[model samples]
Target: MYQYSEFDRQFVRLRAEQFRDQLERWQAGQLSEEQFLPLRLQNGWYVQRYAPMLRIAVPYGEISSAQLRVLAHIAREYDHPDAALLAHAQATQDELQASQPGLTLAAPPLRYGYGHFTTRTNVQYNWIALTKAADVMDLLASVGMHGIQTSGNAIRNITCEALAGIAPDEIVDTRPFAEITRQWSTLHPEFAFLPRKFKIAFNGAAEDRAATGWYDVGLQARRNSAGEVGFTVKVGGGMGRTPIVGSVVREFLPAAELLNYLEAVVRVYNRYGRRDNKWKARIKILVKAEGQKYIDAVEAEYAAIVAQDGAPHTITAAELARVQAGFVVPALSPAGIPSEVSITAKPYQRWLKQNVRPHRLPGLSVVTLSFKRPGFAPGDADAATLDALAELADTFSAGEARLTHEQNLALPWVHASDLPALYEHAQALGLVQPNIGLLTDMIACPGGDFCSLANARAIPIAAALTEMYQDIDEVTDLGPIDLHISGCINSCGHHHSGHIGILGVDKDGKEWYQVTLGGADGSALSGPAMPGKVVGPSFSAAEVPDVVEAILDTYRAQRSSAAEHFIDTLRRVGHEPFKQAANGARHAATERRSHARQAEAATA
Candidate 1:
């Protein structure tokens, strides 16, 4: 919803030109890959597998319909026609060579992909694939968007809840603060190269949607006893190899000095954070090793520099004002929303019950489009689906959309009356799935697909489990199951917090998964739900769902009626029963395999 000024436009244009020149030189071989690596990365270009993938930054998941149209245009025109050749086609590479004459067109063989993420929607383009994603940046500069500071050891996309403006319990609007941090951190000279990547998130609501406790720095809006605006600061939290639920380093910080406090924190890390080991260099490690008391001491020491003995006056009020202006809330409709709608009729009831979040404004809601659907690869959508979403955003809502960190799209500030019509449109697009908070709605990493770090494919595993739970009644009865999958031990899919957690591991090229139980949301800080016994070494794809069903069945039998949740049941009965159930499933499968082998040997 924010418009760009002439300066903003010019800045993007200049950056685009810089990247275009760098790309040209690189293609000409004047700039070698070694020299061009940093340059290309700065421009959000990565030399992924078959082609060069360009990641376009969609800051904090907010984008206007106009900017999306720019993206569609880029995708259509620049992509190599031959690069995206469909699977199981008879056109061999030789045949294509014979037909096209003077072209070296590459085919991805069910492997080439153009996917998006919540953390800066980088428009990843395939290298040697017909499309030159730098072309997208050139066009993007004309509008307000650019692929700047998306990667590298820079301050990553400063995020807040997508429903920042609309969430009913918000103490104050957090979107503006997030936007301010983005502007401040964008290519800041002091922070261009840090000890590790920095992540910051904010939550203004009573219910923390930003995963506030999981960031390097988190801000929760609150007011003091005197009713003055302030924030509750949590620090040193991160997930990746070390999962730490951040502690209250500063306890409480006044809103007026929020930026100042943030500066102090960043300054501390940039100065003292470890740079020797890439894996152990995160600020979280620093926070963990040194203790919170040390961190607080450093913060206080640096915080005094704000407006004290002069530190450029520490981000002048005018600078913050300019950044805040960019995040101005839309003029919401004053007309009342229909609260008396019949919830018992049609699918609107399910949607209202699940997807809709209460807005600060009366009768309005922020609608989250859950990409975690039953039997689909988590966060995988084709070009047509992207265009469909863009079109849907245009027709319904305010032609504004937010990409969520949970790999979903959000159409915030939807008036209550238009819910049903919008629901119909989404259904036509196959976007009308009713498994938002259910077991089928899952979070999984892109394991063994694009990432070289993964041990197995979380996409297929997630899809298989969702397919297994096809019965709606059974799924409903399971009750608020949060199943998470991590490709490795790093916990990118947040397996630690899942009610039923699946961790994929490599047992000498054979795919094996670990299961964990009784994990729940730990924002106020939750406890670790240690893993149960290893589920499988010989588990087939088809049987994974059966294993999950057994776990659910175990929960149901032990639970007090249907009132208790899977987490609650697990908490009560402990992991021994679930472990036994999983072991039983594995044993049955192993017995079948042994019997088959014995029969073959006897016949011989």
Candidate 2:
């Protein structure tokens, strides 16, 4: 974890103070909502469906136990007591009249830790109040965390592969480079208000866990034949409205010049990216419109800058070393030779296979604790859960934890010998779900429940799916699957990249879902990279579960082998079978309704 210096601390303190003053003005009616929107957004505050939502940045998804404690505190204290009042205020008069006064808050108020994780590796508190927003920022600042640049049309959190330093096949430790970019981009005056929001991702491992190929600037660590480290820079890849994999702008860029090269790319986009239309504002749209001409322009810009004051844009070796020093690997000797461990139970075996992965160190392993469960929203962690997990990290692994882009938590360096004991502790805390890459291990955004922009409620769908597939035997037979859902085309849930993607859409004032099949993250194991294809017509939310089951059943029938993955099977035998199955399910549903209606008419 990176430690904050005195300067860093002072900067955060001052920024929080500035926001506090701004918030006071907004509350006092000195600043209109239109005027205050940008100011509040820059601090990661949003006026959501029923109340204000606050997004806190967890940079690169890394947090220490101390920081986790602060987050837990925020979850406990910042919840608005009048949250139900606000909800009722937004309801229709009839609905309000039908509701019981004390029914909503009958249970003890969930005081803290009511936040969910975002695909961007940030935490969002959905019920935060406007007046408490600055106070939340101050609490975050005290723990070396802040929400600055998280939501505005500025550089958002710079993310990397969660297994960056620990992956066995890692070519470089990417955290240092990610941190360097983080420091450089934070509060940079030049790119403060770009045409659209920008995202950057780094991948150091053989597998692209960071979804680098789908970001505005995707940097993959590479080494030349001579073994000198550099980057394979990909530009303009993004989803939402237009889904495109990035183009390789530069085949090889020396690591030392990464900052300068990126600045050149940013300059190109900032100078010419469309500001007239919000829909066409993202760099992906610009790249699509300009084609190879955009690449040529960026190259020419880089050349001109290098020919001019290149010294100003480039980072020095000393500066690089300072950032790298923060990512030191922990010292570890085995606790001792362990007694033989038994795994007689099927559930334990399944958990070990799914939740545990190899580490770079010989006797250590990385453990992913699934946050998805039957009753819980995917990626949600209450305050008590956070506190318990923090203590677990201190006791079992190091005092550090990593948040995955897939909406899970990783104790990245747990000793192999301590697995059994750790599993017990995790189980007690409702963190041991044994479904990491399985069907129930879903990824979803806070949809219509909290976000005003969402077309449908995503969390309920995820929870329903989890409940539907609670049978361990059924999921085991299904094998590894990634089912992602987004409330809308904004693609916050990364639905476009899932093996099975579900997107919520509004149709005649009703919530319907469109399904896309055969999509995947990164390059495929045997075939070309592809996005999920839209499978025929959109279906009602009520029909989604059955439709999903039908799709799975269709896959089971068409697959070459029991072990064949869903995406591979879908690719092998196109989408027609799945489409037929979905249509059949819809027809059967209609017939059932017709039969029931006929029986009622006969009795009458």
Candidate 3:
């Protein structure tokens, strides 16, 4: 974890103070809602369905235990809605359920006082009041955290592989580069409000764990035959109404010119990207529409920047070294490594196999605590859980933890000898679920429950599927499956990349779900980065669980062998059988609905 310097601490504190002034003026009627909108958004505050949502940026997914505790404090003290607001929201939800009887499973009452981890490695609070926003910001500043550039049409959080520095096959540690980019992009006057929100990701390892292909700017670190480090820069990738894999704009960009090249890329996009239409504003659309022309324009811009502007943003070796020094590995006692563990419990063995991962260091390991369990939305952690996680990090990982792109917390420096005790502690805290890549370990957005833009509620659908697959053996038997859900076309849940993607759609003012099959996130398991194909018409929320089960059943029946994964089978057999199975489940659900109606009519 990067420690905050005095200058950095002062800068954050000053920013918080400025926000407090802005918030006070807005409350005093000195600033209109129109005027305050951009200001508040710049500070990472958004007015969601029922309340304000705050997004706290976790740069490159790195977080310290102290920062974690501050986040917990914010969740506990500020993430609360008034009783009337809660009741009204609940009533509205109930009315929606009543209007569409049998279309959805019974969902538990809505709760607050939690933080949500996003696929972008940010933390979000759904119920924080705008009045208390400054206080939360101040608290975050105390620990070198903030919500800067988390929202608006500016460059958002810069993300890297969760195992950035510690991956066994890492070619270069991306954290320092990611951090440098973050510092450069933060409040950059030239590209503050671009055509739309821009995202950048880095992948240093041979494997694409960061899903770099799905970002606006994807940087894959590589070394040339001459032993010089650089990046294979991919541009114009995004997922929304349009999901396009990024194209390689530069085969090899010198590491020193990362910012200079990025400046050129965003400069071209900013000048030509669609501003009239929000839907087509992303750099992807511009790049897609222009193709090679866009690449040429960026190249020209880069040449001009170097020739005319003196390449002002070039990263010097000294600057790079300064940033790199902040990422030193924590001291670990060599005695922590034992030849072998003697634990024989099945649960312990399962957790060790599922949640634990190899580290570059000999005696250390990486452990991911699952947040996709039942009774909570994926990536959600309550205040108590957040505090407990901080404690766990301090105790086991030298006060360091990283938020993963998959909406989970990972301790990257856990000692191998502490695995058993750590597993027992995490299990006691309900954080040790041995389903890391399993079907139930799904990615989902807050959906209609919290997001005003959502067409349907994602939580209930996630809950339905989670409840159906509670049997660990059944889940493990199904093998590694990426099940992702989103409440709308925003693709916040990264549904477009899921092996089995569920997207909530609006049909005649009712909630419906469209299932897509054979999507891949460019992982070793998923061969390439490609969007999933829709199977058929959207199904009701109630039918989603059955549809999923049908898809899984189809995979099980069509698989060449027990060891074959679902994706492999889907690729081999194609989507025809799976599509038919999903539609069959929908028809069965319809028949059941019709029979229930008839039975009710006869009774009446």
Q: What TM-score fits each model? A: 0.86, 0.94, 0.98
Residue pair clashes in candidate 3: none
Q: Tell me the tens digit of each residue's lDDT in model 3 across 55-144.
A: 999999999889889989988999999999999999988888777647647875788999999999999999988999999999999998
User: lDDT (0-100) at residue 289 of candidate 1?
Assistant: 86
- Compute the lDDT for candidate 1: 0.68
lDDT of 1 by residue, 52-134 (tens): 55667776678776776766566555533353443222243234223321112222233333344533333443422413656
In order, the Cα lDDT scores of the candidates are 0.68, 0.82, 0.92
Deviating ranges (above 4 Å) for candidate 1: 74-114, 119-131, 307-325, 328-346, 523-543, 595-604
Q: Tell me which of candidates 2 and 3 scores higher on TM-score.
A: 3
Q: lDDT (0-100) at residue 214 of candidate 2?
A: 89
Worst 10 residues of 2 by lDDT: 100-109
Give per-residue lDDT, candidate 3, residue 65. Answer: 88
TM-score of 3: 0.98
